[model samples]
Target: MALLTVKNLSVGYHTRKGFLKSVQGVSFSLDQGKSLGLVGESGCGKTTIGMALMGLLPDNASVTDGMILFEDQDLLKMSKKEIRQVRWKKVAMIFQAAMNALNPVHRVSEQISEAILAHDADISEKAAMKQVESLFDLVGIPQDRMRDYPHHYSGGMKQRAIIAMALACHPSLIIADEPTTALDVIVQDQILSAIKDFQNKLKISVIFISHDIAVVADVCDNIGIMFAGQLVEYGRIEEVFDAPMHPYTKSLLASYLTLDKDVVQLNSYIGETFDLINSTTGCRFCERCSVAEATCSLVAPEWVEISPTHKALCYQCK
Candidate 1:
């Protein structure tokens, strides 16, 4: 059975003006010890989906519809107490902006120990400290620096520390939302490598959310592209990267500069953004899609399987 399955999941935020739908009818599954990449432009509901899965959505936001099934348990139906138990023990998250996520007032060791204690009550303080030290070592941070505050660490080290905290509970699933953002390429690679190494060693599943298609393409086994609160395409990473059927996916790949194309220019790329507040019954990408036809504006596309385990939501593909 799949480790995590999210079906017909819809989420929205309540604004002063009105309710704004952010994620609509999104569905996907991940198997044990596998990684799925969630990629999209900003405001496409990538972070919202991550927050929903972690049960950390803001007060203004709620799961308006759908189910999040993790190991056969429905997360949407679980109570706050039940969800609390499930979190960190079964599922953990490494949030975006690691610097802000870490507490400025507390020592890093205290923060990590808190996570460990929450998951395993029987663990002694000394034992938890030892485990925290091990985690720091695992994530390539110096063990002696655990007493330092969040401000003491560099951007990359802070990210590493966040990863360490996420792994403190040894959860089965880790949802990392843009964990390498704003870091140097070298530091990003190191963080990615460390994450992959830990995932391999611990046999953990991951949902890595990022706007950087290149980074996601490198780490994920499967890729799911989101556009305007909906999944446009999902398939094996290689298949999606090599032969993207969706116009949005193709555009994303085209925007990237590869080694083969040393002086790549994006003169043909479309520049349009979808208005999320306007409820559109038709294809969300129709406004921005280069290949959009008249039918795209009239009828919503159904997801059609193009190859084994590959699906695209486009009338043209159907």
Candidate 2:
């Protein structure tokens, strides 16, 4: 069974004018000990999907349609109390900004212990502390700095601390939403390597969300491309990168710089930003698509499989 399955997931925000859908019909599944990368430009609903899965959407935002199933159990259908039980213990999340995610006032160890205690009531203070230390060690954080507050740690250290907190409960799935965004290239490599090591050791599934296609390409087994609140393409990482069928996917891969290759100008098909509120009919990417036809402006595209494991949502592909 899949560790996580999101089907027909749609998220919307209540605005002054009306409800504006941010994530429309986003669907995918992750298996145990596997990683799936969610890649898209900013405002393409990558983060929204992550938040919806964790039930962390803002008050105005909600999952209007779809099911988030973890191990065949529908998370959307679970009660608030039941969802609470699953949050840290079964599904943990590493926020985009790890520094901001950590509490400035509390010591690092304390924060990690709190997460552990919240999930496992039988775990005493001493056991939680031991687990926190073990997590610190696992994430390559020094034991001596366990009592230090968030402010005392460097940017990378703070990120490692956040990762430690997330792993305190030994979750089955970890959703890392741009976990290495603000860090430098070297630190980003270190953090990602650490995450991979932990995933392998624990046999945990990961949903890695990032706009950095290069980063995702390195770590994920599968890739799902999103554009204007919809999944445009999905397939095995090698297949998607090696022979991308979707125009958007092709454009994204072209933007990356490979070994000994000069940087290529990224195809900017989309304008400044996509207006999800005004979008009601037709293909959401019609205005930006270079290969769009009159039919694209008149109707939404359907997802069709082009290969055994590859699928795309485009009339041209069909």
Candidate 3:
């Protein structure tokens, strides 16, 4: 069985105007020791999906339909207490903004140990501290610097500390949402390398959410392209990058400026942001698609096979 399965998951937020659907009919599965990257524009429901999986949705938001199955158990159907038991022990998350997530008052080691203690309350503090030190070593944080405050650590170090905390309980799955968002290129590469190394060493499943296609391509074996709350394309990274069937995926690749690609004018996809409140009956990318047909605006597209392990939700592909 897959480590994680999200099937037809729909999430919505309550607003002054009306209920706004943020994610709709999203489905994907991840196996053990594998990683899947969810790539999209900022408000395309990438983070929302992560939050939904973690059961961290706010008061105004909820999972309206579908299921989040972790290890064959439906997380959506679990009680709050039952989910809490699984939160850090079974599945953990390295939240966005590592600097802000860490408490400024406590030392980094204390915070990580606290997470361990919280889940395994019977464990002695001495034991927890030993585990924390080992985690520091695992993530490349020096043992002496374990007591340093968040401000004492550099951006990359802070991110590593947060990662250490996430791995404290040895979770089977890790959800990293925009983990390298604000760092410099060098620091970003270091962090990515650390994450990839950890994933391989521990053989952990990961759902890496990011907006940068290049970064996602580097770290993930599988890629899921999201547009207006829907997964438009999904397949092996090599297949999707080499031969994208969806127009949006093609545009995203064309727009990305890479060092290896020849110099060319950066192309932009022309269209307004997708409307979440009043969604169209047809393909969400119809308005922005360069080769959209008349039927694209009137009828929703179904998943069409592009290759054995590749599929796209576009009529053109069919």
lDDT of each: 0.91, 0.90, 0.93
Which numbered prediction scores highest in TM-score against the true structure?
A: 3
Better of 1 and 3 by TM-score: 3
Q: What ranges in model 1 sit over 4 Å off?
A: 267-272
Most lDDT-accurate candidate: 3
> Cα deviation in Å at residue 274, candidate 3?
0.5
Count of backbone clashes, every candidate in sequence: 0, 0, 0
- The residue ranges of model 2 lying beyond 4 angstroms of the native Cα positions read 264-266
Give the lowest summed-lDDT range of ten residues in model 3. 94-103
Candidate 1, residue 157: Cα displacement in angstroms equals: 0.9
Model 3: per-residue lDDT, tens digit, 220-282? 999999999999999999999999999999999999887888956898878799989998799
Query: Which lDDT value does model 2 have at 182?
Result: 89
